[model samples]
Target: MTLSTDNALVVPHPLGLDYHISLQTPYCILCRYAVRPGEIIAAVFGHWGSPSYLAYTLGFSFPTVAQFEYGATVYEKSRSTSYPWLFCRRSDCYNCATLHDTSIYHIDCFHIISKNTASKRPSLRDIWTIASWTESLPKTRYQAPPDITLGAVADETLIDDHESILARVCSIPQELRDIIAQRCPESPAWRLVSALSRWRIFQPLLDPDIEIKGFSFDDIKSWCRRDGMVAGSGGSGKIRIQLDDLGVSRLDYVNDSPALPTAASRSQNAWFVVEEVSEMQEARIETKGPFMRIHKLPSFHLWDTPVPPDPALTRWNREITGNLRILRIRSIALKDITGLTVFCQHGAVRWIYPHHEETFPGPYSYPCDNSPSMAQLVPSAIESSSVIAIFFPLAKGEKISSVWVRRCEPYDDSIPDTLAVITTRGRFQLFGKYLCPTRPEVHFQQLSGNNTATHLLFQDVDFPFQRVSYFAAVSASVNNTGISPLAPSQLAQSRGFSWSSSFCYVSIVGLENVELIWLFRRQVPEGTPERDRLCLGMMLLYEDGTLAAAGNCRQGPDIDVQVIMLPGSIHYKISHKAGGVAVECATLDGGRDAILGDEEGWQSIDMHSRSEMRFWFDDSRTIWITSPST
Candidate 1:
């Protein structure tokens, strides 16, 4: 496309974006063009080869006040205690070209710093700075941070593409690697960021709908402390994890919480709960004697007197050369970790004691007797849990260039439940727990946008840990742009929801009220002659939807809602004129709130009781409340 203004380089890195910009108003570094939410077809200049090659958007840090190791809580680079901008380049590309004089680490390892001479204006990366929306510009596509956040669907509908993936699935070994490397629009987030730094871009965006700074669980623990008392890091007593009042109780538990039995209702979920849900109803942690658990390694023609410098391990170590990432996983249940084995791309190594003799299934062991869980025991995969083990091996010669992990709790969440072990044939062999528990079969509850209801989706609880993304919501939201994209995972091994390219706007009607009327998805094509555009109708009907909160980022004041507590009276549609769907009349009677728009181009809506439309939203699809069974 032709540019009216100079555009930033739209280059495609073999790797994805640097840090998927967490800030909302994502703009082009060069032109400051504000990318509209759900805008798919935009482009930037290339960093290297082509004009519009697809690449991930990189991130830069915003400079702010400082706290030095010498115990001074003050702004940095300041002249005296005031006149902060007395020295240094005063410009707005953020610390794109500066260095943090305070850090011991090299500039590359630290967040770029701004000098005392910088302007007082907030940087574009500032969370408080809401980005200004631009008028409709020439349609174009460029890789931006929003694009990386799964904020919008990258390409068009990919529903029918996965079936075609069978070709690569059964392709010759030589071709399989090529197939995996080729960019498949079906799951660009995973493929592009599979081995890259911005892998968080691939994580399934979960909910709360707020801006989350790069922080660990420990950080949250400190912030949530009401008394503002932090344990002394240098103290020598029992480590007091100062995380209390989170409702994570240890009162109720399974009688035998340590054994998985046949023909019993044992949900392997208790092991993964990091929230209030802490009960694992049916499934129990499989343990033996004083030993908590034992894992059997791949019994090949390998290792009898297994000790250090084993032949298989040394050989595999020699053959393996490239970036290596290890993700550690631990259960909420503490267990004594003993000897184990690590299977690499070229060979496998058994790490056992020198005097310990081993055979076919002899391997690592864990023994511990403690139960402190964060989630309540739910009998199904109705909610998100961490008790999963899988590996995503890179291409034959490709080492995992980047890996993304989350900080759960116990700090040991650092442990990875799954590993992408390299095998002799350079394949990813999962070396952790079995994908499914030893029970006959598992029936997981579906996520039907309702927390209290239950819908049994009787199928194998297949954890799409590798291909699917997972994340939680934020504190607040405006347009729900940052809401984690949701898909009906059980209905399909759904990678994500698909959408057609169009001019779409999302209006979250309620701010703090979690009642009916969640979002309004309006698509208006440009240049559609106003006279010809009859009733650009926007229908948003909600029923029995008790979502916690709502937000909208678009700039339109057409809607004015007032709430007065009355049975079945939750949402009220005053008016909306932005889309030519001006409300000609609105009335509340009998329990139904009816809205009638102008005749030339009208929009109609009804907001009422079970009549209150309870709906959930993703970037792509809309889920209406039809029945609790859904």
Candidate 2:
């Protein structure tokens, strides 16, 4: 890789008129955990970074190109792990075990910190809050490159050869690879070479073989509206991703987070349904990396057409076929999702509750770009402010029984916004947005465990496009359910708190709920006049159906006298009395009253560790039971 006199410019400013040297892309590393925003950062760095720090983070001035844009100057000679088409391929190693964020680095690595060069450079949620505090040990991943023959692709040749992966998958032809091989027929060929080098589809105006040859057959039957065809649409059950297709310094990465979340289908998959209404595009992390822009509101503009159709593929082809016939009469699959919402209309809409898919690649959208904005969330100037509101309505056969997310914050360390979830028969889905409704915040930072959510974790940092600071939800289960031998004497026995007396404390934080669908008790109305009156009030439907209170109940949700409906996989034990309100009991399954429901008495843990959940209040208000937290 030593051939890089380091000019890495792709569009590094100065009237970027056909400038060159981005050796067909690789270095997107400014540490966006799952990088892929703007391109250009080539890094074959032998003499080590600093071409004026890529001209002050790519601003301009490299003037000297009498027409140049060839290729193959990324110094070849065989370095392994083939780095293929990236706009998404960063598997976090900020808690470095060998510096692994292939979005390249070295302007003083963590952005200049020679023991402290005027501080401030953390953000990527401050290095994922110290890499979510302590977690490097996974080491032993082949290792090798401490310089045996002193590498840099010692001579370079493995661009995953075969005429360079067939000149990068025949520039997306074979009719856009049979329309992206019928929308990912069991992906891998890094999902068709990272969706044809991430829709840069050899750019001749986003080439579908030179400006879409009218993709025909209803754009490959409206982007493979499911049927059956999984065996690797590229043939021979494709796998190919050994790494280094053209530099990601020596690959092997993955401590987990190889990347691929949204992009169900699209070869113009009929913009699915486009009335397109979303606008906030403030943007930061800079250098062409965050354009969630898609301004095209008032559509079809009162047609007076004589002969005009292709306004970017026939103005959404008849309203995406009337929204795919209203998504086939709302037949919503993916188990009809049920709930998951994220407020802020003109620039954030985490939809998914029957409104399942038409596009969902949040945070400055990147299910591999081409955006005409079909609602890819994350933009907030405080319009709706409802952190993780709804997806509420669900009755017909009602079945999402449970799934969770609540990280809350309006005080303390600040910037967490708020979130929450529940179901089986409606009336609880209140994670956020329903026309701007959000007013309860007694502190709830984490919970997730009533199943059905293979994955949905938006911990804040939107790629290198940072600053959205909050939105947390984590759920994964069907087997392994450990922890709760009453967790380390219930977080080291503070279940009897006194933190040096003086009273007035409240921390109802259910950090990692193991399950509990509903229970918003607010007692003392028995025979009225307050029966023996220590009159406790309560609220807590966590594990997603966030309904706070418990210490600050304040007679709301219509005085919740008692709404007990538990069983999100059982294991409840909440005894209360934290300085006032008074909640005495919420028992089930475990064993300070029988909790360990088996699985070898559970204690497995290791979910990438690092967990801490707080909730302390005394006057005998000690509710205790645990499922997650290290």
Candidate 3:
């Protein structure tokens, strides 16, 4: 017998396993209390008639039946002193299941209510509606219309086409053929069903008014006969017809029906028609814009300069390649430092880390920690360096002490002559150490529009001096003609020199808030014809992003920033503040110079060029030599 879609009963019990089984078969019970709706119970032993069954067969009153079910009985008593017969000692509650059992009494009445509850059944329409609404869907069915089309359907061909897939299914491997057959059975063109199943793909079609009529297996067979090709004959004299490529191509068309338009599709004037309600339910809306949102700008990678090797410069060549290692050190003392200053010339200014202990630490002093506070530079000019002078501040009763320089070898081993010792009357005896530079290159000062010209002075030495050479160029930034001050003969006052250690000074004709960092190196060692050791130089910080650097010779893995040429004039304004410090700057043409304006304000710095700047802060004390005129 065929299962009717309607009239399908659903047991009310949450777990109705036994009740379902009983519906499928038959069973007997002892009494109403013998079993629950969903519980399993054994049949009576050797008894064909149960309590209720026996009552129905024996014509007993409801109360009699109930008493028997409870293992009770009735008897009549004799004369006036006694009953005619012996009656049941236990009283019987009438079975409310029948009218004869009803009485004017306070009874639970729940048993009667249960009978009515059990009799109430669900209608065929309700079952069908619920099933349609709550059914789970298969994956192959489209749940929504995708913004970007699925790759599978993009190249699909019409089934009616001779070369289409329906025809090709027969030629495909048995496994693939079986998979397709299981998915799309040759039956009713249930486009609505398919559409509803793919709700995501056809959500716009979701409406109470939408109706889909189902078709029978015979109807599908006729459709297949008209469209699909009969591939072979079966064992039972039946024709085994396979959906040809042409027939399959026409399947979607045949199933097509009016579809509700999606918001996005409607805006774009797009319309579609699908066959099954399920297919319509699964329909999706497509947006015209991008499939995925793209949100940020591409980043740029900076290329590092290659380092050259020179045996003569070995003493100043301390750097770890490809590693930014963290090191621990002591904090710099303010008393042992000197020459803590900010100078401005032309349209530029820089805090110079000259021989000041805070500016440049020698070997004997304790190593100071280089941190964020020590290396911050803002309103930066070209190649700027901030030097802090540290020395022991004289105390009322404390006596001054002697200070010495410390030294070390390549392996961090102590070298007696690494630094020089000195004596002062202040309570603190140690020297100063500058912390950081602005940026790695001299690119900054040029941006501020400063002149970069310098004259160098050096010690006369022999072969080693001859082995070393120097070059200089200058930029005046006048008439929009970028003539740099770095040229060897840019200014008559500018000095140039060649020896183990060198020095030079350039004037900034134009450019504001400018700074200069001087590069210094030793080409010769003591006892030798030349003195190849570390030297000391100076750098200025600018308010603008530019920086300026000048000195004897710069070291490798240098952190000093470089200046780039621009097409404008630059100038600076310098002012002296209280406490022996000054603000040196070459802001813009008419811009005011930037420096410490008040006697009391927290000053932070830029350590952008700290790598090279750190050289001055190191214990070696040899990045720059003294100026000849000084």
Candidate 4:
């Protein structure tokens, strides 16, 4: 029989009985019997009367019908309690009643309905049945085994042009790849791998190559020395090696034989040699037969005359291989190192190195004729002195060659306090001293060849006539005739051509309340134009003894004295105060004005003991200084 939303299905017993059974509506069943909506129909069995006949037609036994009644009663009671229940109906077996919102049935039939829905009545069952079904199902799908038949397949054709080759190499085991990477980092494959390896973030991926076994600090030093590289010990015992030219071959030897000589040689030699043996064992051989043994002898005996040394190995070799000359001295403790100098006379350079523990008995005389060659002056000027300077005469027609130095003595001396030399080509060679103790720090500045004249000024300053001496070196170059010591004042005033000057001023500002004033006058050549021809500057002394100089003073007489260029002359006035010092600059043509220190302006400088100051000016017309009393 078909059932409608508002109709109940009635069926007569098939045993020729007159009695009929009718399912009640859900609402009436719940109200009259006080049963849950889900278990309402199950309660109708109480009105069935003679359940044997109804049960026989439905294929259920008498005891099963009683069990259904008992289960329905328990489920309805459970709805009143806090526990949840599942309900099913024969007509809508797929739709099961849920605890929340009875109108919304549970669509997952496996979770709510029994396996044999036909045998059991649509009534509430045990709440544990839902959980039992869930446990019976598998957690995940079954996985198939990998195909071992698909061996190492070639994927080169599948890789796009944009794909990185290093990424493919990384997929291989790192243990096998690391050895190849470390041993030959210059290989094409390694270069590509290293380029991509830089971006790896994990520690395991970074520098995967193992450390080389036999590479040591001594090996590194030997390689550097052979290749003319720089190797030295740094702070905290760290070693730093720098290769100026990587094209030079590194020294690699095995058993007194050169290994990996060059890229070309390495390719031909197969780079490395390997030996394989199935077994290694000690063996001894004994022979009883007499045999004649002959040994090859040298062509000449020890008593024979020895061959002469090669001229190329001698100190006076004259081959003009290159124009660069280098002189290096290893280690020596020369007290008067400042007195050393290399003078270039005619077309040769001369330098002196005294023997160990030997002192000059008297002052050595230099060549009187400045243009004399080494052959003419060596015998007359330096014959008596044991501290004779080594002379290197250039080729007869060659210009003065450039001289370079690798290493020398006075390792802690930064500036070479030696005499300057003027080459025959009219170029100046400034001496440079390095301060590096573990390594060489050579400093060489090529002087302009166009400079016609150069001036050397040695000034000694002493405050309060103290015994402590302060020496300052100032070099000035001009495009005019060179000046002698006696005619410095006259040369300063001479003006025949337009000229430029460069000078450095160094001074130690004493602790006393002395007003240090510096006066600079620009000496314009007589015929030169006067528009903006003069510039002035002042060096401010810091409490730490370092100097800071300001140039082109244009602003005001500010608190921190501002420097300005006046047409005639400019001077710096420094006064020592209690907490700080005051500096002022003014033109010679006007009355002096005092500038007060302020926050936005130049703050007062703290005065300290023996504060030092230095100023360097370049491309100036002329500069001079004046000292003042405290």
Candidate 5:
């Protein structure tokens, strides 16, 4: 068959680039099942037959013309049965005794007959026979002249050429070919060609003829060491050379992370171990990253020598050795001497002494050498007119050892002068040749004396202080205040009461008089007795002189008692009396307020979530909380 010149190969689209590859067409078949092109054509023509009528008038089969139709199948079913029925069935028509649709099938049948007519053209081989010229013949014997095409050249001469059919081979160099013939006599020319081609492709890097001279044994050895040939030398341990030239020693790590020397026998010539530390002037620990390294300082000091050594190494031999002892000695006063004692009634006081000018130097010193003072004596001052008794021992040498005293300070807002006088003994120094080995204990005695005596003698004996007491009472409902019989029925059925998960409660308005008594005692005794009976401390008399009490009466639950601060120090009795519980006050400390664990009481229920309690204050001269409101 003759080839068609009109249908050339499909070239890529001309985008600005010289060569281009087309984008892959998406395969609808691969992604999902889809209707065939024939089905789609049938559906479109069957629905609208404008193109089908044109095909019939043009003498073409409707099926063949519909091949180029552009449409998609709308409905899904067996297209084979559906399409044929649509094409064959019509209003009225008969073919081969069977009625078929003429209107629909006319256009598609015309194109099918046109394609069959085009297939009857002359073949290409028949035309080639009439135009043939060249022929071939074989020679059996006799010699003939070499048919060189160029020398006997003619416009249309037929030459028997074997170049296309015969196997071709590239000749190696004559010298190399002779050498191969002598050395590798078993190899054929084709095999030799193949071996050379393979060698060029696989081992193109085989010994190139580039001259490299002037390198001696020592120079090469030194170069190898510089390139990391020494054992345990470079950054990591392993040879730095290529694998092919790596002798017999297998490298542990042959990476490019900085070469290292190999230490195996086969690599003995490849590396050398330096017994001494190398002193290079440029050797410095880089502080570029997150860490810092301590590098050996250059042996040559900058002030002493300007230029560094040639081999530039460090003295790695010297190290600090042998026993090194640290001694710590503290010198203290050998003997105790007289010291001053002070008692202040109110304000705070502090005192310090300086013996002489600082004896030590530098940053650190004993007794704070940085703060030097020569002051030898100081005096006292008064914030208010309060008594202050001070006793001091007079020391001959002035080396005072210890100072002690029992002091009392009181703060009274009524008295304008609240602070007492404070006396301080200043610094003193004793002259001596040597410190005494034996330490003498000196005692300082404080006697009852007064700086402001008149104030103490005329001051009032008692002071007014705030006192708090507690009273508790329960109600059936949050806002209700009514009392009922102490029974389950009274608590649950009464209109004045309410019920909770655990208890039924009724309002107890009259039971709000539960009072609290605070009894103060210095200590708790083993058994109950008259001597242990605490006296009435402070009558927590509200201006009315009646103690405030809180009530706790709810539901059918009886009043539960909790021991407050001390044993019998504070006690309460709850009874369902007509008017409620009566409260009283008593003291267990005779005439004094409780020192510590003594006063105990309860507080009234805080309706608004705010409650308070009060008790006598101890010698601290401040009121204490007997009970807290709940």
Candidate 6:
């Protein structure tokens, strides 16, 4: 057969002796020319250099060009090869198949004639030849090599090897090392390396083999005796004490808070056993049945020494171990001590003793030490205050069972009279009067379940030096086991006590043998309002005095009273009957007036008629009652 070289690769026919055959062509080689009746087609060879060399003996008659195109279309649409195409030696073939893996042998033009295109179809051997050729093709597509420049190669060379990189980093100024470390990627390996390096630098200062002596709570007697002090008694029998790395003795007790009534009563039974005391610290003892009272001792000086004066005492200017349960200060007069830190199990408490040149030494006394002083620890103030006591609850459902007491020179009257109690749930303030002039005491007890009560006893030394005491009760209700439900009268007695400027009002009503108490407070605006404002809060008081149903008040027909006061409506109303009080708002002479009844007896009030009435007890005290005309 004769062929054109424009779009074909002509090769010697492997089976034919005198005739030539084209192995690769754009059109079908078998159907490119019509076969004569006396001539025979030659065998075509493919994949010249590939492992898979397929040969097809072409002896069949050629079909119509249209029929050939139809078969090519069918083959293109139906054929799926597992192997990529073999790379051709031709330059054009390489470029055209740069990113493709299809066969470049032009088999579609040769053997892919559709069966329905002609009456005579190719034999089975011819079909097998095409299938085998497609199967052996390569599967991976070719990708072009990336362009590389001499500058890029030079830049890469500048990146030092691992050893060189480490050496360079180590050689930099010490200050810059931290800057580099901060910019480094946050990988575990990098972090470990950094930590190890830091540890290496500080190795000389650390005592790797430092020995700490372990001791049980019972053994504390021995340690206290070493410092010539008596041991206290009545701690948890299961507790153990250990001397920590910082040369401070620590008592390790169970982190769990003491159980309710059982633990509370058990604590009272325990007391420190003191046989004798030093002259620097005094101990007052009174034995009355199982109870003993001790007078607070005055302050003493603390010095920096290898061993503490008392092993039971906290370290000076160092953080106490976090696991300490009970911290008993032998000297309760904490007026001049500084840098004394105590870490409670639930929180931390630090003392800032008042700064005085005569009371404390000058900075030159401790030249090498850089620890902060009491004046520096707190915000700049003329005088400092010592945190005398701290109380906190230990259990999950427990109310704040803690109190913090501070003693100052009583110069700043702006200092709040209340102490903020922080618990796991939140924080609240407890306001009370001083119980003692020298020592203020606070006691917390769980009445029932999670319900707690606090008793504060302190002398009011502000003016006439009178004795004062306060009792506060709160309900946590985490567990069920305590006080009975609260009555309306009980709730009235508990409400309306405010140390802050916020005004509180309580109204009680009885219906169907059930008493209900509603508490109301005026929302004070930050700035003076052009008109008066009124807001109401309703609450249901249970028999145990716990408040519930607290929500905003809505005006409706079912409501007993809708309290709304306008501007210039400030007035007081006294009930004729003792202990009978109410808040009423009415329009008198086309002006609104709100009246709040006082807690004292109101026998002097004349309420016979619903008219505008005013009572002047003195120049400073006045009472007014106004009834709107209906």
Clash tally, candidates in order: 63, 35, 176, 3, 39, 28
What lDDT is reached at residue 67 by model 3?
Answer: 26
Better of 2 and 3 by TM-score: 2
| Candidate 5 or 4, higher TM-score | 4
Report every candidate's CA lDDT: 0.20, 0.25, 0.21, 0.22, 0.19, 0.25
Highest TM-score against the true fold, candidate: 2
Q: Which stretches of candidate 5 lie over 4 Å from their true place?
A: 1-626
Candidate 3's error at 481, in angstroms?
7.3
For model 6, what is the C-alpha lDDT against the true structure? 0.25
Report the poorest 10 consecutive residues by lDDT, candidate 3. 99-108
Candidates sorted on TM-score, descending: 2, 1, 6, 4, 3, 5
lDDT of 2 by residue, 1-630 (tens): 122223343213333222222321222222211112232233311111111122122222211111111121222112222522222122221111221211232232232222222333233322222221111111111111111111111111212334543245444545565555454322223222332232221122222243212111111211111221122222111111111111111101111221212333222111112111121111111001111111111222111111112222111101222211212111112255433333322122233333343333234221111122211222111112222222233334444433333222353122223233445543333332111112244233223334443333332211112112223222334231221122111212232333322222233334235233223333444454221223233334445544333222223233344343342232223223222222223243322223343323222322123242223332233233233444
RMSD of 3: 38.1
List candidate 4 stretches off by more than 4 Å. Answer: 1-574, 578-582, 588-590, 593-630
Residues 298-335 of candidate 4 have per-residue lDDT tens digits of 11101000121111211111111211111111111122
Q: Output the TM-score of candidate 4.
A: 0.17
Give the candidates in order of lDDT, highest first: 2, 6, 4, 3, 1, 5
Which one is best on lDDT?
A: 2
Q: Could you tell me every candidate's TM-score relative to the true structure?
A: 0.20, 0.25, 0.14, 0.17, 0.10, 0.18
Error of 3 at 553 (Å): 21
TM-score (C-alpha) between model 6 and the true structure:
0.18
Candidate 2 regions off by >4 Å? Answer: 1-40, 43-338, 341-393, 397-413, 419-426, 432-461, 464-630
lDDT of 6 by residue, 556-624 (tens): 222233333221232333433321222333333233322433433222222223222211111111122
